[model samples]
Target: MLQETRLIMGMPITICIAEGGAGARSMAEAFGYFDAVDRRFSTYKADSEISAMNAGRLCRDAISAEMREVLALAEKTRVDSDGYFDIRRPDGSLDPSGIVKGWAVRNAADLLREAGHRDFFVDAGGDIQADGVNEDGEEWRTGIRNPFAEDEIIGAVRLSNRGIATSGNYARGRHIYNPRQPGDELDDIVSMTIIGADVLEADRFATAACAMGADGIYFIEETAGLEGLMVNAAGISTQTSGFGAFEIQ
Candidate 1:
């Protein structure tokens, strides 16, 4: 097995291949893709495409195809989630921070699959995309961390060619926006984990659910091919009926 972590796009991106070191080159190329993604998408960087657009230096029509696609996807999420998944920052600038990690991770995962890598995982922060089995010949296990307690796991998910994403204050503080109040802090929910058909959709919905407060679980329940768990500030939990199907238990 070959596994490594690299800091990219302002997060620890861990890539694991269930093969020998011969997969190292592909993994390196995967990281290179991540690097390029960061250079283009990082909102904090003054030269990034997002920053350029926010600074009014880059025209929206002149943006790269990937940037356009990401923004388009963000807009779709905003619509699908009824504006809860919007990327408009407090400063009134576009910030696709919500879904870029999953998007980029999905891209890397696709690289592995295209290269005939059957068993691999690309994890960007808590958003994960994995396929096939691990070294143990079992599904990849993703622990959903406790929001109120560091290093404590509240649950574990068994992913088989699926994607999982957890959104909480622990990873990025209250970075998630409550679009209804615009600039108001998220108070109703402390954390939310979403398991979906793919990481891109999962992460976007997770962000939207975080903004939806405890009611987000209902949103996931109603959505097709998605299941979710939401924990409120008081530690009360709720989840879709099928969510337990992904549990590692």
Candidate 2:
């Protein structure tokens, strides 16, 4: 038997598992870990880890091993994407929204693993980490929303033991607010989705790559371990190496 539970991690989060008996309770316990971490580390919150770092109250030396890992990832992503995925705005405030959600989701998934749950899915907002097979003993199916057409799905992918993340201008609007442009207006790409082993890295890469516009698509293609599918403003779709694994529905 399969059971699903919804846990509040500041935002609503769903955990699905196939543990037969007590699956729901185990899923809830797994989500409890997420809630605790969300309260302590969520960058979206005003007093969270990144906020403390931005305020200079949380020294880099004081950062936990987990926080340090995510921060290091953010720094590496900034460099790899040529500053497209900056955690701080010009005002020096932290805006790690692009990466934090996926990071949290991945961590929550890890919690499930630690709890002895073998098959599960953790979704934080649009970011996801799916392990094992679904109800039909098949890979989980996830849809990629069409940025140009609201409520329409451009494609879907079936995955097992992998992560999938999408980035677009539709949610927050604008192309991730170009740091280089400052106050200048920015254009939005149709959508960009990436699949990889780590949802955290894939999420940040997708956002940064989309923010880079057409030029970043080439960079994404050259980057190793990451596969991307991008829809341009004109609705043309392009794929990076290994992106063909995604089935366009």
Candidate 3:
């Protein structure tokens, strides 16, 4: 097994390959992709493409291919979530941080797969894209951290060829807000975890659901191919009907 962790995109990204065939070069390639993504999409950097676009230095017609793809996905998520998932800030500036991490993680995973490495895990911050088995030869067990207790894990979910993401203000502190009510803080729901077919799907919905507050779990319940667990401010936990199927005993 080969594992590496690096700080990229203002977060720690870990990539673990549970096989021997893929060497250090494969891992370097994956991490390099993440570095390129950060340079292109990071809003915190003055020279990033996103920053240039926001500053009016770059026009939409002149944006790169990756920028176009991220924008399209952001628009799709906004429409799918009824404008709950949006990248546009109250000031009309764009910040695609909510979706970029997961998108980058998924792309990194694809890069590894293209190199013929199947059993691997890619985690960008809290969003994860896991395929095949872990080093123990069992399904990847991803834990959901307790919102009230940062050091404690509430539970673990078994994932194989799937993605899981958690969205909450506990760690980041009031980073997500309802697009409809920009000023209203999403204080009702402290945490929301979504599992989907891919990291991008899981991440986009998790952000949207967190913005929905207590009603987010219901949205996950109604959405097909997605299972979610929601923890409210009172520390009460709620989950979808199929969530149990993915939970690790």
Candidate 4:
């Protein structure tokens, strides 16, 4: 079965799943699961888990099992990124949007696998996770949009059972602010793409790496099981060790 549907998550959530005979039905079920997770974890919602934590009604000790895992990952990312991937805003509010979307998408992919779909793809607003190749037997091809060029692709990558996430200043029009340097704007880097086994890690790494500018490349390269490529404001490109395998076409 192969099915596609939209789940509500402060917006339309389009979910797609491919399986033998129950693709549609299974995807619908997965959407239900996704909706539940969204309601519980969404930062946009006033009553979501993260909102609760921000309100002081819940702490990390009182978080749900699923959120506990996400929090742990967030903590690890904050450490690995040298505090660049923080969840707290300058005003002391939790802003997990950088990592939660990818986390949810990856979890949806896991649900699809549990439903017997060996191959699937989940794209939650550009954060992507693929379990296997597409129907053509080739790896998934992801485009790296050119920030300065309209309708142009600067590069692309072929991914297999991997997660790819991009953080760019272009998407939100300078909305990706740096909490550490509240008075300073993030310049020099236009976008950063990170690929890794975990979508959450990839997402946070990309965001933090973009904030770090040129200095972040070395950290991403040395981090085990992670690789990244960055496109700076001047359009200069730099990539880590394993990043060469993903072609820039």
Cα RMSD of all models vs. native, in order, equals: 4.8, 5.0, 4.7, 4.9
Q: What are the lDDT figures for the candidates, one per model?
A: 0.86, 0.73, 0.89, 0.75
Error of 3 at 147 (Å): 1.8
Top-lDDT candidate index: 3
User: What does the lDDT come to for candidate 3?
Assistant: 0.89
TM-score of each: 0.90, 0.81, 0.92, 0.83
Give a tens-digit lDDT track for model 3, residues 57-103: 99889999999999999999999898999999999999998999889
Show model 3 residue runs off by greater than 4 Å. 171-187
Candidate 2 has an lDDT of 0.73
Q: Residue 5 deviation, candidate 1, in Å?
A: 1.1
In model 4, which runs have C-alpha deviations exceeding 4 angstroms? 1-14, 18-20, 59-61, 170-187
Which lDDT tens digits does candidate 1 get at residues 1-249? 999998877778999998745789889999999999989989889989899999999887799999989988999999999988888989889988888988998999999988889888999988999888988988988888887676899888898788889888444435443445443444467788999888888899999888887678899999999999887655667889999988877
> Distance (Å) between predicted and true CA of 216, model 4?
1.9
Ordered from best to worst TM-score, the candidate numbers read 3, 1, 4, 2
Q: lDDT by residue for model 4 over 117-144, one digit each (tens)? A: 8777887766778777767667777787
Model 1 regions lying over 4 Å from their true place: 170-187
Task: Write model 2 residue lDDT over 123-186, tens digit each, in one string.
Answer: 7766788888887787788788786666898778887788878787554345443556543333
Q: Compared to the true structure, candidate 2 yields what TM-score?
A: 0.81
